[model samples]
Target: MLVPKRNWLQQAGFLTGLYGQYLKVYLKTLVEYRADTLIALVAGIVAQGSTLLFLTVIFQKIPKLADWSFYELVFLFGLAATGKSINQAFFNAPFSLTGYIRRGQMDIMMIRPVGVLLQAIGSSQELNGVGQLVTGIAIMGFAGAHLDLQWTAGTLLYVVIALLSSAVIQFAVLLTISVLTFWVQEVRSVIYPVNWLYDFTRYPLEIFHPLLRGLLTYVIPYALGSFFPAAFLLRPESYGWAMWGVPAAAVITMSLAYCLWTFGIRRYSSVAG
Candidate 1:
């Protein structure tokens, strides 16, 4: 009797290769409409820019929001925005699973050997998010420099983990809701409110009522996207505990999304007429 080969590393490599192939095709479409990418990038930058301007004006009138100063708030905004832009650039496209299900267009993918979720995302390139990326990094850097942060090696490591965790939280929440379309067949019902929810992270979570704060942190887990980590960095003694929750929130929400997706796939039946 011989043990079966368990090539998990090979499987991981195969998945990576699949993602690379999908991204290659997705990006090629950008050349067909180069101006569109610029337009997209500009649109994101303008949206984020205008919000920052509004916040700036508000802060000029009042010195602080809750325990956070203006620059600290900006740091949170930048972190959240950057994470969102990265998601928009690379991962959020997969939420279109709802659209494919409704259109009966997912049949092709069902027959394919690659992961459906990965293929869904790799199918499209949203390069306009590049604007958000640039704006986010610049703002984060400006805020980080001005804000008196503890710049330890451990702190820097936490920042990097928090950034990634934020992206995962955003995508996991969106995909979790969007995955419901497999059964509901209503895209607007699921995706439209994600826009509203996304705004919850653009400022310090402390400003919200305790109930709402809990909703954002545990139910939606939006604070993990930026606010929690920013707070941890700004006042480590106070919010350092929240930093660990950032990655934990990501893992929990994403795990829920995975379970939801598995259920959705099992219940998935062709809507083709």
Candidate 2:
């Protein structure tokens, strides 16, 4: 029974089909709220756009902040926004777990063949993140052209890894906070700090006081989501060590978040309606 029954392509093909069906259902619901989607998309665009504008205003007065030029800072902002948008698109929909817990809908997930976490995430998709995705790509491309990135194979590969690690780190933070719901029986309070953190990530981590820097880097490690990766991209030799730490930090923090989630699940008692 322990046979290598399917090759990697077969497994990937099956998963792709599953997600395709998932997206199909999501689109059916999405069309019913056409206006809401438009508003969300516009809000995402304005939000990221305003962040870039902030950088523009700052650079107009000062030559650079922490040795990062306007374009480089925008690249960091783009990294954070892209990673966040991708996470919103694929997972961590707002208020999903709260509804599940309070309504005892976890009972429904209990009998499903898929994992509860997967089912919860699969039930919601954020197409609004498209605005952020578009904005991020545009900024990154503009910054890349100005920065004159070498685009060597090794540098390109590192870029891919850094971006993926950034996404992983961001999602891990959100999930870790969301999983606190299993204890408190609510999510809003837990989710607030993470929401606040995005603003900090849109800028360089060094501008803050040392305590805040430590918090972002070590305690929470939001730095991995944008700053360090961008730092490595802009100044390779100086930030090489920091770049390598992103994936390692992602794995360690995500593993801890998963363990917390499983522990919370064990302790969970659903709220009665």
> What TM-score against the true fold does each predicted structure earn?
0.90, 0.86
* Runs in model 2 lying further than 4 Å from the true structure: 1-17, 27-35, 93-95, 269-273
Clashing pairs in 1: 41-128
Query: Which pairs clash in model 2?
Result: none
Q: Which tens-of-lDDT digit does each residue in 124-156 have in candidate 1?
A: 446777778888888898889997776789877
For TM-score, the strongest prediction is 1
Give the lowest summed-lDDT range of ten residues in model 1. Answer: 1-10
- Best-performing candidate as measured by lDDT: 1
lDDT of 2: 0.76
lDDT of 1 at 158: 82
Candidate 2 per-residue lDDT over residues 135-220, each given as its tens digit: 77777777888886897898777777877777777777877888877766567876877767766876787788999888888877
Model 2: lowest-lDDT 10 consecutive positions? 86-95
- Give the lDDT of residue 113 in candidate 2: 52
Clashes of each: 1, 0
